[model samples]
Target: MGIELLDRTALVLFSGGQDSTTTLAWALDRYDHVETVGFDYGQRHAVELEVRSVVADGIRRSFPDWGDRLGEDHMVDLQVLGRISETSLTKGMAIAMADDGLPNTFVPGRNLIFLTFAAAVAYRRGIRHIVTGVCETDYSGYPDCRDDTIKAMQLALNLGMDTRFVLHTPLMWIDKAETWALAKLLGGDELVDVVRTQTHTCYEGDREHIHDWGHGCGACPACELRATGYRGYLARQQA
Candidate 1:
């Protein structure tokens, strides 16, 4: 059976990246009311933070139906995460594989902390659903992105907060290619264009160079995945 649309409100963890933007579209399509939250954790690719407003505006202007459903946005200051994390995303270091076979770009406990804060905000706002874009497929080996971890977090949030907040990971099982397709499916070419032109996913925070997929350094792992996924998406379309 097809999933039933929830008439409740949702708060999406939107970072203005392709995946997050896509997930925002997904939430806007499903929920009656939708809000957004972003974190300023002093990452190297802070450009993603700047583009959040632009992408949100694009969605508001292009897709009026979703625009009507879209609601307020929130920003959280988690610079402490940056201070505490020694990974490449939080620090000025090379993106390399660590000894434990994970990318240095993996900021430890990022999704966990994000969910905790999001749940707090949701608890106050009386929102029942919290949406995020963390995916294991086509991801950079982040343990927190795993399905099991998200399920555990969901259980822990309900127990700790005493609220039955349904954590939504719409992109958890999908890869980058399918993600592009999902954008197209959710909002058509206009939404796809918003994702391709407005979102920022480069780890190096280089928005000066624009590619067909979007703005990025095109060499970072994030860019590589996005670009490869776009290519695969196109190939499937042509196939």
Candidate 2:
């Protein structure tokens, strides 16, 4: 089967998590020229940065065909963004509801900024497509994860930079289980195994307490959502 993509080159906003890793595979499958970019925004789960390094290396080693086509993987430092935001992901504060009913983990304009920086990077590299793993379903209530926000950001980017950059959200409408299905479809079972065992999604970044969903503390909302989705996907496969 041929990979369904309108563009031949892409840049994925990879974070070395389940969804972002899956998105990377999706890009690798379709785009002839693909690269990944990650952010270091002073998050509490700094281990994910290490995980990103390992996962990027693993992709190059395991999937040589895809890796050969892959471009330079970038890790941009945005600690100033974290310093200005009071989110739990960055500041390690309590997970309380904000005045707008969003979680304390909602870092305002983080995704927007990430996508904008990604657009600049892509424009410089002559890439027009930017793939992100943001989703609304089974998400952590980050407003920036919404499709509308992405569209707005895309338009803002194109207008601001005078470049026709297409923001691709492959997992925008899919839940966690469907995201796993996508990984299997794009990279096959080995890719599924890699994502299940290698990626980091825990808020605490506890690699010791491995679960069906991946490595997580099992107490945070991210772990709960991931584990539940993995169980659902497994059941679906069995049935």
Candidate 3:
């Protein structure tokens, strides 16, 4: 657990979703102080902040010793800066989440912007290690989530700030099944409870189906991925 030495401090890019919630648990174990950052880009499902606040609050309650390590309002008024090629997340376009191929849900430069800002935040705090829940294996054609992109960004951020920084993505190679497995490893069955109840992955900004793990729509691309991963995890357990 060489990575566990990161216990003193780290920053997390949280979106109150399965990936981010899993990242939070992972952060709690490894980092002595984990600071979570979430962005509000006026997304289609902006209700995520409500869920995010709940999750952060829970973290403070559960890890009272590490109280207030979570930071709020890492978000920007992205609506003004959100202009890009037609995207479901950037625009209110009713684009279907990609199923067979890359979906419109992929907002260009989103992860780039978020990570850069997160790095800036870490820099201000004199922290170099930053943890995020970005996954490439399970990624649905989001160009920003690639390993090469991450490395490049790391270089750019470090050079721009003239400081040492390590962008850590624990779920990069792992699929969602593995992510669920990791969450369970960190938080046990509580993983399911928090992921399903606290995380927000809905394109529709829903909370009605909070009990359905991270799956939002049965037909949407995001929902399909979550369902597939969850089922794969269950199958593994059964086997």
RMSD of every candidate to native, in Å, equals 3.6, 4.0, 4.2
| Candidate 2 residue-wise lDDT, 1-239, digit = tens | 11233368999998989889999988888889998899999988889889887887788888999888888888889999999998888885776778889878788999989998898788777787899999998897898999899999988887888767789999998999888888878887888888989999887778998876788889888888888888988888899
Which pairs of residues collide in candidate 2?
none
**Candidate 3 lDDT tens digits, 168-195:** 9999999998988887788677666668
lDDT of 1 by residue, 107-183 (tens): 99999999999988888788889999999888888999999999999999888877688999999999999999999
Which residue window of length 10 is worst by lDDT in model 2?
1-10
Pairs that clash in candidate 1: none
TM-score per candidate, in order?
Answer: 0.96, 0.94, 0.87
Model 2 scores a C-alpha lDDT of 0.86
Which regions of candidate 2 fall more than 4 Å away from where they truly are?
1-7
Q: After superposing candidate 3 on the true structure, give the runs of residues whose Cα lies further than 4 Å from its correct spot.
A: 1-7, 61-73, 97-101
* TM-score leader: 1
lDDT at 75, model 1: 99
Q: Which has the higher lDDT value, candidate number 2 or candidate number 3?
A: 2
Error of 2 at 171 (Å): 0.3
